[model samples]
Target: MFPGPTGVTTLKSWPESAARLIAVAAGRETADLVVRNGQWVNVHSREVIAGTDIAIADGRIAYCGDDASAMIGENTRVIDAEGRYLVPGLCDAHMHVESGMLTVSEFVRAVLPHGTTSMFVDPHEIANVLGLDGVRLMHDEAVDQPINVFVQMPSCAPSAPGLETTGEELGPDDVEAAMGWPNIIGLGEMMNFPGVASGDPKMLGEIAATQNAGKVVGGHYASPDLGSPFHAYVAGGPADDHEGTREEDAVARVRQGMRAMLRLGSAWYDVKSQITAVTEKGLDPSNFILCTDDCHSGTLVNDGHMDRVVRHAIECGCEPLVAIQMATINTARHFGLERELGSITPGRRADIVITSDLATLPIEMVIARGVVAAEDGQVRVERRAFDYPATARDTVRLGRELVSVDFDIHAPEGADTVRVNVIGVVENQAPTKALTKDLPVRNGLVRSDPTQDICQIALVERHRASGSVTNGFVSGFGYKGACAIASTVAHDSHHMIVVGTSKENMAEAANRLAEVGGGVCVFKDGKEIALVELPIAGLMSDEPAELVAAKAARMVEAMGECGCELNNAYMQHSLLALVVIPELRISDLGIVDVRRFELVDLIVGN
Candidate 1:
């Protein structure tokens, strides 16, 4: 049941709840709460109307106009806004709760004060580690929250065919079964663009299942080339895409009837470039949406959540009202939640944000479902924490303790100089560049060249504990010291990724995580410097957001101390194993040439 008095959470129950809503709107019944004397940011008319009052009953908006005196009763809770702008609560169109390193409830507790009332989360990261059971655990926790947390059934568990191997694989039957869930909004982003273009049966079957169930199909076409492959993938029935990084990418998605989601996360600053389609090119802004595809605990607790994205969009020359619409009504309309919780209209949920200014968007008070949930960066209401089962914890299982020899990159039979394909990291973006470097072999093994910022990266199989380690070289971390950074939060496959300048330190970092369940660790000079223990599915921490944020901040500091200065380098580190994205990536199987969608040899004879 919904937290509201009418006890209606789904559209199926709206028929029985309509009588009370209609009665309060007509002034025949008393409202439960009333907000007087505020300016309404009406997204329906795309205008800011002054002198507005909202009458709320049974946790739904009954009336919103200049006068609501007739609906006020003796028991109604009256809140005087004092002429603040009553804006609709923000909505994150796309995100992953595991990215925040917090569970669903803690994520809600963290973002509620930032005026985000709704989130469309894709749990594909955890799904790769625990399969359908993981999705069910997340879905059950999401539906119990005070805010709206819609779950998207993960479309691709391995994310790409023949590129990476995951612990659990999901098929079309899994997609069809998740459709019957109460909170499953749609299928998650179909990251296998190559499979979609080539008419792969499994990929097409999953998309058709979502479509047949009348649910949205999310897309992730990361390629910049908008060629026939892009057209073929679009023709395969995906509705919305968030992988656009350029203005043309946004324009192309909208031109093809897909919503172009502009994202501004901790590391991915894609909004400034893509939002130019609306600000400068003057394309239709209605088809544009705003989101944070991935964010860490530090960004959520320190900078802001949706508020940071909206403010950055405004700084990128978007009008404040237009940016707010992208975050609120546009996102709600895209997910078919416009009538439920997007606006301050009659029949929508009573979710309002009181702000002193439109340009800065200072959140003063947050009203979610007619209850004052948060005010001034703190939650006023209490939310219970979810206790994860022990089976979900202690997921790190390495059959044997790792050693420096496991990370040795053996040169070909008689080669002295080896030409290697390196995964080059781009700062503040998701894409990577494939670089080649020729280095001399030492003792018949290819060694890392720290002077060229080339470090060794290995993907250790953590799920099966086969003790398999695939090693490769990566650039752009700028590490100059004896250090290693290891994480079990690798995207899509959720394997253990360790990047280090020294193989000894890499072995030390990996063993530390295996000993302490699962976590992110930084080892320097054969000593552990910083660590953030996840211990839950090897992905998220069950601790409070504040404690996790503190630990994450130290991890960032440790990366800096090790001579890596990229912003949110841990996010870039975790995605190195994601084989769906372009250029190059590493997996437990081997090094993958993502552009060719095949496994490639790490070293070429020179």
Candidate 2:
């Protein structure tokens, strides 16, 4: 998600940065920053040059070579790199900060220590829910950061119009307007693969606007087919794609003149499968890029972000130097920012990562435009608080209090068993299976089928509620006891998603989440057990990242107590209403068959 590079401060270029580094060397300047001696991993030429000296002046790279003793000023604060490998700062080619469930500032605080100096972010997450105003909110926040954070206006609002209903929808008009913004690098992912393949007028219009403005257009071809549909979509004008999960997918994208962004996100593990094209197939590495498509806050803190992706590429047999290229220079080239901050060239930003080892990538220190932003795996910069508008904050609009009756699915008169469609949640991925099971009826209400691991799932229309409730079934939570989990952080729309082994618990859980404004809540044995309050957009917490993660972990533990055991149960619950995924999904309207891209009655005709 990128517009112009405003608000978000650009780490001054090496030309300017070099001046500061030179001043530092000449004693005429006590430079803003200086790294004494660090091994330089020059990704541009795929070489691990060692014992390199880097100089910074006024937030830009002034001098970068074997030795900079001549550039050290009397007052220059020098850091002893101790022969660590100095690599260009990592960059995420395409990502959504909201997927981490953290505000832009919080996300920055979490990733800065991991050596991510720049991100080409698509704020479509907010755009879908809050429109252009939401995109501006995130854009302004990124502009205030210490590193490079660029925004891309969302090109697809409902992602797949008519197939889904988001709280707000963006059109080509919004795209044209965003092109004028300083930080807007381009249009966000063009997710409507079908629309592109068919040459849909609206999709074409958005692409035309982006092209007219000379910005890169993102692509998302989620379907596995690499046939005519894929070809048609590729020819439709998207410049890059990250949804590929196979070697062939990678090869095809590169051959077609698109950058293949390999991602290893918190839940989406795609890099390992696709990197084989470069490692074993002898494909050119320049066309390949690295990104974390989605990462929750815990993963950001405990694991890493772009750094994690680089390490994973190494594990997948890519040379460490090539891996760094994918994260830095390759990403920069894809976004048309090759001369800016991608490499350790003379004119680039002073964004470099000092590492002791090249293969393992032990980030010893991180420099952003000559400033010491992180040291020894710790963030050195302070996160600024964005003034969130009250209207944009706590947007859980549940029109009425929920009751057990709202969770009820009536059986046809005298029906012994009712056939219910269930959404099968695949762990670590966003795809769901359209499953059906016969459920027993009691007191005129159909019951949840725990034996099949099927729990009752419902979507509550929190945006203007309208007393609308769409009830469906979801599997994979493995709930065995009287526990129900509810969350207001449903994908895209951020409605309330409730899933439970029991209707009573489901009612309690869903209602409690609504009462809490927004957040994920788990209920076990009737009483409210744990809650993760997300007051920001009913999807993020204003509290510190650790605090939100701790609360989130407690919610997961509560789910475990209720006999629900799944990897990252919160992710599973959050995706229940994601219609773009597949098989089956629930909306404020009713059960939707995503594979068909159409809504259907809950009870399929027998």
Candidate 3:
């Protein structure tokens, strides 16, 4: 194999290797590899043609037709497909690698067996903690992979400018500098949708830099109101969006010339509700793409990746060919990479998946860059772990040990009972509901009402070592005992978020993460039940995916034991501090009313 900088297969430019490819296709040169007697799932034409053969030279498809036997030489390696379907390798249109609690290399290793050969990753989660350097780290590691892993320069590090603060900040200059990187696909999801709609110069400058570099701009318009703000956001130059949770949201995005990404992550089940725009309304399927926005390691190892999304789409009333098209060609076309690696077409990278069924979509074998990367649900290649710098670790700086008294919320003067705003979690979705509940006060302090399912939530500042803790109330996880969970992997802004019914348990959870540098920990009745150590930027671990997934499974079980019964409750817990999505969230600043885009008082006085 022709190795690149880090032992990855080096793909020569089409111009540099065009003559060899042409000669191989014309039977004038020997082919390096040949796959014969397979049914090709043609995404471009939406047809499955039988008796197909493909010829490869220098890690790219040189010829694909009914027969390529003429190009095969005595030394050429051949694989008999045995009447299997030769489908293009699947692509994840948008995702975050850090969400898996594994590094880029580990994440790739975990999903390669699932037939995902192409991924458009947004490393904004790390950017929120380590800034541009962190993005560069992930970008460098991504290019060293056997498959295609494109990085999008993070557009919003803090996510919301004035609403929250992070360990690092990325601006327009950073975006411009990153455009010159070899693997940068475009600007990451513009999480600051309000900033884009209001013509914020910083948001526009980043968008302009991406456009000026001739790259696609990703979007995250996380609002249900598709009114003036949504239109303004579209006008600001985001080529695609993956935050649509409704059918109208998908229709609006496609109608406005933006690709709509239907996602089925570990927690977010959005494909069934939004795919109707194409399957039912008769809209073009080319504008709809499938993605896993944020899947944990447990989901990647125990379940599947893009293959799972494709199967789910097929089960959601979409045709098998149409779902495959949505996952492959549609995503490639959106990112302007259709000519490079989307289908079983000549002159493209030789990334194909051999499967026996279309609807079930079992990934029997996966070939990436003309090499057998995985077969029979096992990776066949070696992937080395990328060593992160020491500066990237030990990021959980809580300044001082947190105590139970620090979490106490003093009641106003002498109020016996007061109504307060609560963040209501919506299962299987990103958006939360703004809710209110009345609670009794004892001894001049407000207490969480376990009977009403209301618990205390805190966002502890970990970046500046400020020792600042902002407290709020959230109702959704039906926890019964004195259970608390703490995580440094909070979205957009990687602060420490602790949610629990008991102040003492919450303190213990938060202090444990700070002691371990960073990670997610569950504490019940003053005992640590589960912990997943993520020493890299306090967001990811370099350990093997199986080990991490095992720990994550235990964490999930612990949540269930604590009386929390939400599907993927850990995901919902991690996103509580995401101030971009409505309608309520907590941050280092204070409790944010996302609907109004301002900080609001916690108490409702009569």
Candidate 4:
């Protein structure tokens, strides 16, 4: 059996593996497999060498050069690449598996055909609901696969300390305990920028534990202000950041001795702006990485995974070789796995992608651990479904059925017209703008104005079944009909967020998610139009990725029927409660002013 360079629980067996790898390369031992006649993309040297043959032994690359006939014995399997471009398998340096709305096994099965062989995932979405045990469940399932899946222990549960509440809270002890687990990479994104800048003991303790274990610490400074606050966050021990959306933001991160990760996910198109740091400003490409911070299953199924991100980077004026380095070796070096599985060289894991073109980059074949895993957009390997425990399912507890009155926002006194603070959604971005709108009040209750595309948004506390509903306002959905969308995938906190133009439809949407344990649903005119039931931790579906992607596509169409014109509006709706990002967001506590990092009044001048 070919063993990948992953799931190495102990470091004692490396010496024996290294001996066999050297003997095979020196023609003293027989090789298991050899890939012939290909253009080897040497990410380490930033060059493409033609007519290269790779010898594999014990699932590790033994040689990469002009000829490997010496090691090819009678039993060796020869794979003729037909002179294709042999690119190293792509890696997503940062992401959330829960954002795909599928389990780890399903996520791997979806991206394997897309040439994604490694992923560094953060389970913070599940951590917000089930705590460390939830993270362990994901980690265990990640290692059982044939590819490399590194788990980053969630550093933030609520994300923000007091501005919002969650189903569970993770502390320094949780971080310290996860450090010793197999496949544990490092700490997840530290979203508590305020806590880090203020020298909060709890936040510092988690960073200290990760550094003591000699692991990487992810950063999330959502603020665009590169002032003293940004410098303070760097001093807090985070080694990289993916929150940057500008060229200057990337420059600042690299200048501060941290890697700047450019992300092109389902909704966030941030690569065009940040990649200019290398294309125009001539910054070193080694300090930059590529990732997909959050991608829905619809994007993964319709579009490619890391292949899509790499193509976008190449289109953004980056050289194909340079962009390949950003996705391969640059990511591996960031996580201290440079010699393990990044490049197609001796001693690295035998993960290869045979592509027909460098610019278009169509993946024709994928080989992981010297075995063919996928070919021509089809997964050929066997993937077993993980049987998630019953405790992980049925997590949506609304306590009681919500009614129209529960979503109504009462005005101050007997006011007829009221000015309220609203969360302004930015197209293809994570940060929201704090905008105020003046609207008519009927029966002393503030209502949504569909003519102006202003809709009412609410956050329902489902963790403890408190039946607490906090209502606010949001703009820019362009929703005109009597429709509502609800989801249990609110980022960082995982609360149920309901956004709609009608109170009755909003109530209907919330009840729909509660009925199916948890998931996303769209309701129009007091009836559910589409839904995707995610029974595991109220975050991921136990079904196949293609099945979840189908339901998500219908949900997107439902948003279109209701007058939403934004691309992937469900992704934007799910992020309305993410309090870690600026400038405004709603939470279980109340409407939070993220810039101020405090709970503020929803009604202005009250």
Candidate 5:
């Protein structure tokens, strides 16, 4: 990657006559390091120029031009550039580190090789479990890294008030405590969009603390309506948003002076839809930041990080230079790091990536703070392995063994056929529908219609397990073959969600997962098929990312074997309980009508 960058930068600036003369005169002087020649893709100038020599000292680029011979010393390592394009290391504007199911150090190793130097991370998933302590643990790990990893204190614990109950709730006090941490950049995504718009005191207090600290506040306005509520949220001081799934959403955020972060993660292909705001509508790309809100370990190891976003933007008709600007300098500017690491400039961190092709972005080498961290798809420094506390494991408590009677949905007496509301799952999307279906009530028990693919979905309360199980019907999995899937990795609230065609299989799936402390398990004909043990707060596995990815892949294959063929099945499974993102979801209490923001009954049309 270093040689590629040297080649690309040198090719672009070869026309300067005085630079070559100076280089020839002062061949080998004293300097910390020297990359003999390279081509530089300058995001600020929006130009690709070659014949550039980068001089570095004290982890900062002292000079970047064709004539850096005067800066080179006998001890300085001279790396010959074999004509590769040198660009600034990529920056992820918004992301959730835990979403990848990797600890901070593991996530760093996975992405560092891909040339991602800086990240603005939100750990709301863990915060929902362990509150401020969890946030502190993440913050402590971030400050010790070799590269810049900024933490954003999570503002919403349950995500939506009155809709769900998380294990721990973070209020304004917790927000203020995290604000002073060394690595904390600001508040995380304000997932409580309604709270911010409605002037909820607790939400406002957290936002005020972030603003008073002089850090940028994050936003999450997921609703389609861009009306007064949206206006009120802008007034609440969230400086950036990543939930803009449309061009109108992007325009609205930018018009209100918030950076619109377009994402193209493994599960979310939002960039193609919203990049038109800049490429077609001619909106300024400066306020638009590119990010990957959630990426699994597989995508990180196989596909590139910010390079993927830049490629997607270019494919959506954005100019190559414009796309680079969005991923680099534009992102740095949003985080108030414009003068630091976003560009290939003097006094900036000598973090850069060398790629063979800008369009393909085949990353050959990755450098961070003037040291090679990864080369040719390999990590240079050993990544740290964190130990999950004993208390973190074995957190799944079922209270008592579940019985078939627990899944029974009581309806009005003597009703031959009952019309019920079902949480209709949508594949590859966050939203669910309040679907209704009339079913035959036999033996005083509501049975699932396998022909209609309306499988039984249940939320077995894991936190403070009062043995409270909320059962409902959900379609769209296309499950068959007496298989059941259970997971403690439910989003926001982190309850155990079980979906199955057979109650017996469901019980086995749920119990087997509990036996392993906490994890995702699939059962077929009362026998376990696959399980990914997440013993840490019942959220993340302590295993290496590659091992975890393999387990997750097996889980996906198990879902496929069970007659379900949805894209990124585990993602859909994890997000089933995310009340903030959609029309309908299930919680420990009962089914939630997200549109109305109220607790809804499992039995409808009673």
Candidate 6:
């Protein structure tokens, strides 16, 4: 059996064992494992060939041909595929492990059973809280996983420089230093599109460092406009983009020499809309890849991971072979790892998924590095725990106990009503709408109108314990009654974001997270209704995925009880403070007009 965490680094390089692999392929030596009589779903050729036999040695494919009978010996372990489809292990081209609400080890354990053998994770969420130390922690843990877990150096710590503030800032120096790490793949999604287009030194320096290291530069151009700004951003060294929402967005990215990553995350339903670029428009499918940008623990444990994305793509009219290619070889090629993995061809890592069906893609068995990792929807390997240091926990510091008055928004003196800018939540999407509302003032304080589907949103600074609260208005949660939800998982800045219909409930929810180190909690009528403790830098929990999923499911139920009917509304709540996406977002600094890339007053014309 393979030794647990150290097995990853101890795996011999292909060169060190090439002679043995050659001998096995030449039928002069027996293979360590031989899988016979399978229908190879050849992703490279977009074809399925039956009666294929694959021989593995030294954790890499030695030979895949019509027969490996000559390489069989008495000691060789042989598994009869029985005509099962031997598909390449699915790879999530882009994702955030922290968003899963589980530590790296737990996230890997949860997804491995779903046939996700490789993950390209961007730890920007944790970077917002613990800076370089946070990113290093995840990187170290990721390298120890049994499967491929590549870490992308975070490109935007604050996401937007002046629009918000983070616990730490990562500049070009940090990016360059991280590029030398063992598993560092590239710079993460460049959320600062405006900075890149305008030739901002810090953003350009990071891109240059990744390019200099011959690594891929990921992109996040979260704008609908495919005009000059988009073109400028593409030229700024980002080789791929996963923020495209429309068919035109996908088309434009591919046309500009950038790979278009179509995502089907828990809350993001973007695949159906953008997949037409290939199905209808007849663009070459090679430039298109599938990914899940963000998925919570419940989604990973219950629904699926990359397998879910591939099935959804097939449902969107993509052929099974093409969808499988998008999820496998296309992702590997995008990251310049075609020779390492992504296919069942010789010399690649022996990462294969066996399934009886192509369309449904039920993962009957998963083999990673020539070892059985998962089978029958269960992980077969031992679960390894990566202990996070004490410094990574108990990060939530509210400076002082918050009260209902701390959430009050003082109105202009003697004003009965005021027009305010509200952050409008768009269901199943990342961008919010900038909305203006005429809200009444009571006792010289601006009030939330629950009847109008409007509620108060506050960004409480947790990193520095500044006791600073930036309050604003938001709509579209459909929340009723005296309810509030607070999470320290706010994007980019990782501040505590509280959305509530009542000031007292908002205060209670905020204080609840503070009291428990850090996590997400919901409050109704001054009582805690649900909670999920994410004590690791306040972005992820150290617990198992199922336990966290149970808490998350209860939290979702609580949201529904409070009258929020939006699908995956909790995801929407967490992103309310992401200053990089469109329209409006609240931050530690103030209400951010993301379109304008500047801070705007909460009250209009004040």
Q: lDDT tens string, model 6, 63-166?
A: 99999999999988899999999999999999999999999999999999999999999999989888999999999999788889999999998799888889
Model 1 Cα lDDT, one tens digit per residue, 1-606: 375312334222345558987898899988888999999999988899988999987677889999989898999889998899999999999999999999998898889899999899999988999999999999998987777899999999989867777889999999999999999999999999999999999999999999889989999999988999899999998888999889999999999999999999989999999999999999999999999999999999999999989999999999999999999999899888878988999888888999999889988899888788899888976765677898788678889999999999888878778899999999999989988998778899998898788999999999988999989999999987799999999998999999999899999999999998888999999999999999989999989999999999999999999999899999999999989888899998888888888888887533
Model 6 score (lDDT):
0.92
Clashing pairs in 6: none
For candidate 3, lDDT tens digit of each residue in 1-606? Answer: 334323755566678778999999998998889999999999999999999999988888999898898998998999999999999999999999999999998999999999999999999999999999999999999978888899999999889989999999999999999999999999999999999999999999999999999999999999998999999999999989999999999999999999999999999999999989888999999899999999999999999999999999999999999999998999899999988988999889889999999999999999988888899989887866688999999799988999998898888997998889999999999999999999889999888898889999999999888999998899999998888999999997999999999899999999999998899999988899999999999999989999999999999999898899999999999999899999999999998988889988888763
Model 4: residue 121 alpha-carbon error in angstroms: 0.5
Residue 171, candidate 5: alpha-carbon lDDT? 90
* Candidate 3 segments whose C-alpha is farther than 4 A from its true place: 1-10
Candidate 4 per-residue lDDT, tens place, 1-606, comes to 333324432221235579888898899998888999999999988888999999987777889999999999999999998889999999999999999999998999899998999899999999999999899999998977867899999999889988888888999999999999988999999999999999999999999999999999999999988999999999999999999999999999999999999999999999999999999999999999999999999999889899999999999999999998989999999999988888999888888999989998898999887777899999887765578899899789999999999998999888999999999999899999999999889998997787777999999999888999999999999987788989999987898999989899989899889999999999988888999999898999999899999999999999999898898788888999899999999999999999989898898998
Off by over 4 Å in 4: 1-13
lDDT of 5 by residue, 322-364 (tens): 8888888998888788867899887677788888788878778
The C-alpha local distance difference test score for the whole of candidate 3 amounts to 0.92
Q: Could you give me the TM-score of model 3 versus the true structure?
A: 0.98
Per-structure clash totals for the candidates: 0, 35, 0, 0, 27, 0
Stretch of 10 with least lDDT, candidate 2: 1-10
True-vs-predicted CA distance for residue 128, candidate 2, Å: 2.3
RMSD of each: 1.8, 2.9, 1.3, 1.9, 5.3, 1.4
Worst 10-residue lDDT window, candidate 6: 1-10
CA-lDDT, candidates in order:
0.90, 0.80, 0.92, 0.91, 0.81, 0.92
Model 6 misplaced stretches (Cα beyond 4 Å): 1-10
